[model samples]
Target: MTFKNAFMITLTAGSILASHLTQAGSPVHITVKNLSDQEMYYQSTSAMTQAHASPTPELLIKGKGSDEFRVTNPALPDVTTASLRYTIGNKTCEFRTSYIRTIAPGGLFSGKLNTAPKWDKKAISSGNATCTVTVTSTNFSDHSWSVVFTMK
Candidate 1:
């Protein structure tokens, strides 16, 4: 090869090696939003807040589908029912839930959490009920994602 061509090839090879030796690019990030209603319920039923107790702040992810949701939460205490209460206009609405997350720390359980939500304007007003969601976590860890939901 000609001297110029040879020099160009050598330069190209050196640059390629240098480029490969370097690391680059931005990192992937996961953002968690507290899309949770920034409200609180002092007196309630059918649902509880994530800050109620230890193993609390149980994250509830609401979504839509026939596929059952499965999560592990040991803090859930035994309860006949649990729910999430909200007020759409003057009407009181609730989402009844049931869960089968493993009770023992690290243990995994599976079941349906009250898959259906309930909305009763009278239930909320007559019962003097506040907006809330009920749940039972035998383990009671603050990291339980007890319920999952999707925004409309």
Candidate 2:
């Protein structure tokens, strides 16, 4: 083939590959909903046990409102641990879990944490409280796993 033809072919192939890679690297959409009448504050911490982990920001959802965020390239380096803290009124509840590796691209795992989190009496007046926590891990992969925490 001529040099001009070869260059055009190569450029077209590179563009196609880049497009596919961009589509595959879509970010995970996270939604936090507060069903209670009281305003809720939340912060999430997620990391792989390796060096140089990114930090997540603290967020707030108004009373009976919902908030959404996107996580790009989640659950890096095989395994990841995450903690989510939710505060409503005078009560604060925390949920923690570790994400496991899965073989399938879209595999999902879920669990319910029905037990109450330990609370400090002086720090939080309502020490005896119960919050239903649900943990869901979806799109299991090395760099694309998404963890969702739902508290009620």
Candidate 3:
């Protein structure tokens, strides 16, 4: 969530929630913080940018089969159900694959990635890709919430 703007850098965080319930009001509570060398102030982005980070429902697809992963309904509000894929090396293997159906504000969904995916370890040292969560349209949302995480 890092944005480059001269001497200042900004990081913004929001959540994505997908379920079969009703979306009453707003979905995400967003905040912007400025990390800069100079004493800079916080200025919000246009509604267009906010719309990008806002959470929406989509497919929990995975594996080479790309199946629809299921979860209990009526999931908590202000949360995200993310299907994360972490690769080991340049080859990009599917390490850990699951849905984090809840991401409360100021909280991190932490877990150990699959160091050894269902691949041949002896023959292959590592094969992996970036951690990307692609949102799919559900009965709730006509659109999808898609975001890409930059590998560090």
Number of the top candidate by lDDT?
Answer: 2
Task: List the candidate 2 regions with Cα displacement exceeding 4 Å.
Answer: 1-29, 43-58, 70-76, 102-129, 135-137, 140-148
Sort the predicted structures by lDDT, highest score first.
2, 1, 3
**Model 1's TM-score against the true structure:** 0.23
Q: So what's the TM-score on candidate 2? A: 0.44
Q: lDDT, candidate 3, residue 120?
A: 10
- The candidate that wins on TM-score is 2
What is the model-wide C-alpha lDDT for candidate 1? 0.32
Model 3 misplaced stretches (Cα beyond 4 Å): 1-64, 71-75, 86-90, 93-133, 138-152
Candidates sorted by TM-score, descending order?
A: 2, 1, 3
Q: For residues 40-123, what per-residue lDDT tens digits would candidate 2 score against the true structure?
A: 887443442112223343367777786655444332333344445678866776654443333443324444323212111111
Query: TM-score per candidate, in order?
Result: 0.23, 0.44, 0.21
Preferred candidate (lDDT higher): 1 or 2: 2
lDDT of 3 by residue, 38-134 (tens): 2222122233222333342122212321222222213333333322232322433221112223323432445533221110101111333233332
lDDT for each of the candidates?
Answer: 0.32, 0.47, 0.25
Q: State the lDDT of candidate 1 residue by residue for 21-98, as single tens digits.
A: 442211111111222343322233433322233333323322221112232222332222233344323334444444
